[model samples]
Target: MEARVEVSPEQEARRIAAVRRYDILDTPPDGAFDRIAALAARLFDVPVATVTIVDTDRVWFKAAYGLAGVTQVGRDPGLSTSAILTDGPLVVPDTLQDPLARDHTLVTGETRARFYAAAPIVTRDGHRLGTVDVMDTRPRRTTPEQAGALADLAALVMDELELRLTALRMLRVERELVVVEHAARERAERDRAEIAAYAATLQRTLLPPALPEVPGLEAACHYTTASVRDVGGDFYDVFPLGTGRWAFFLGDVSGRGAPAAALTSLIRYTLRSTALLQPDPCAVLRALNAALLSESADGSRFCTLIFGTLVPHPAGGFAITLTGGGHLPAYRLHPARRDGPSQALARAEPVSLPGGMLVGALRQADFTSRPVRLLPGQALFLYSDGLIEARTSRGARFGEESLAAHLTHHAATNRALGAAAIIDDLTVLLDSFAAGPADDVALLALSAATATPTTAPSGASGTAHTSLPLPARHSM
Candidate 1:
């Protein structure tokens, strides 16, 4: 018969203190610990497995497998409480035959647990707080390898607890600093203005200062924020690929403030670097999806984006292939066919892209690309959801149909309107809104530069230039 182990009064008090120090009891279930418990059950071929913390009055189950709806039991007759009384693994081949556990409530009551094994979850300083245990209804014996594996699992749980404790401590320190800063700042207005300025500066760093000049292609972009106090998620960029091709993208991240800005920077870097190696629009986006999924395993961050490549066509202007990832549809504006000297505007055509699923939402998401050609006097316009979802002065949503009609009107009235002119007109419209745009607005336009302007519109200058100011807050 094996001798029973006893813990001193001081030792038991230290163990309870260790459990409280971890701050893990009564907390929400953790995925990592649950997985460990499930794995332990499978390894020992037992019907029940649990990671438990032995408390003063109860044995609390942090993670349980095959023990449904049972959160805790009285400390005295609990298997976990007995397991923690020893310094090493306690394996009872048959509960009915073991002198120490034979009269335990778990064995004499409805549980009828015949076989049991557990490794004490001991901290680095030799304080046993809990156990990693498995129970079976039938008598069984475990090999040395199985017992050692159980100990390893207990060590893993301790490591996880230590990591969680470190994270909690850091969060508490950050909260304390925030409290001190709040108390120090006496003027609310000064704090508000400083935060807005900082947000604006950070947002500008996420985008290119000026659109790159693509040969034979005129590009212009403008950004308008709905509120200066809040950091918006809209971003866009155009860059050359060095292979006689150019790449551009416009998108909105899923959040605001520092997290959104960080995500925006990561997305831009991933897209640019991935496109250099594999320039296919769909493939590049796939790489980005993989990067995002790997970085954010919880799927907390995502974006709606349109990625495209522009190549100089031998026949005329440029050939553009675009792929959408759950983003708004882009519009193509055609110049009126001239039977004589009179010029008019053609209706806008919405690009229909099939199989474009939300990126970073799933591992097997599909993105499709569509090819379009840009002729002279034709332009491709891309804008974020803020444009259409914005509320007009009349309190009605400025929907897609209304936006299309407005674009057609401007194209017809302004004969010299190119990429820059189009963006300028939209910026003015956004500023005129009574409430300004309810969200951040980003406008990107690419047009084939015409050789000569037939007639300059009323507000038109000599010719529309792609050069525009850097991203600045346009909302009043």
Candidate 2:
């Protein structure tokens, strides 16, 4: 007769906590887990098999095979309760012959479970949540191979649980963000600065609050809104894709206000999710184009964007791949190599996409992706057309040539042209405009700094530095 092992109160509390953390106790039936349970029954040659979660007072069946009309059983009568008490697979070749398990309700009662085998569903931290268990009417021994397979199935269940938990956490964060937006709307209704507050709040929601710190790279961004009363559709972000790869995008949606803001959110979400599935720059843009077109009722909705990926180069720099979608040319600023006595001035060159067309504008739009290497002291600059389209105090269009000339001049004068330096110079230029820019402008600069500043400061690079308080119509 095998002696029964009792779990301590402290141990039981911790085990129950591990089960609750998954948030899977009463979740609706999942086909993935159901298939796992069904496979277990067939593989083990048992009359019943279940993916059970041992709760405080009962064993809840996440998935059950051959257990019709049974969803849960009391913890005292549940064989899973004892199975979870151990760290390894528990096998009862004959319940009637084992004194410890013969008195279990499932064996002596109507269930008539004479044979039982279960693999403990252990978590990473060593807590056993429940079991992948099988029961039979006739007593039978389990082969070593079958026992090993049962353990493998338990692992698969844990992986699925981890995936679900991650998704749930993200959803909760999104819900919290929505709540904040709602509160901002309520404040707008009660204040005279309604338009300004509302537009600023909505605009912030459409973009990342700060850029992430990419090793061996310096990044900075700034945004300027033309009007406090109207929300602009410009957005940009930089994010990691794991395994030393990163993705970045900057774009502008047509029109302004509520509709444009909504579209901007959709575009950001689609790009991020699609990038994970397919990291290729061209494929990611195609997915975005398809998504935009699908939501367009009359095919009139459109946007301009540049999406790209950055991979760390083996030779101490980054390999960049950029694809344009009917967007203005981005510039690559190359520092003058000091190989000669007369150092040449820094140069700004356009990175034009030969065949790229407007995204979401045409069904058969083709995007062109070009690869470039960002070496030491070199920077990649991206901007919305807003800067080139803006008018000066004399009412002259800024134009692409003038903008390029301005950047080239700035690059020549500064010895160390980091991302922050480039963006700060442009920010001063925006401030020089008498009435500010005519449209919203977004700027992103990435550089491979040769020295200094171990980590890019969040205050300077992560957050968007904005020039917003324009004199339009101030209620309060």
Task: Output the number of the TM-score-best candidate.
Answer: 2
lDDT of 2 by residue, 2-52 (tens): 234577899889988998899999889975577678778878778799999
Colliding residue pairs in candidate 1: none
Report the CA-based lDDT of candidate 2 relative to the real structure.
Answer: 0.80
lDDT of each: 0.78, 0.80
Model 1 weakest 10-residue run by lDDT: 458-467
Query: How well is each residue in 290-320 modelled by candidate 1, as lDDT tens digits?
Result: 7678768776788889999999888767899
Every model's TM-score: 0.57, 0.62
In model 1, where do residues sit more than 4 Å from their true spots?
A: 1-186, 340-345, 453-476
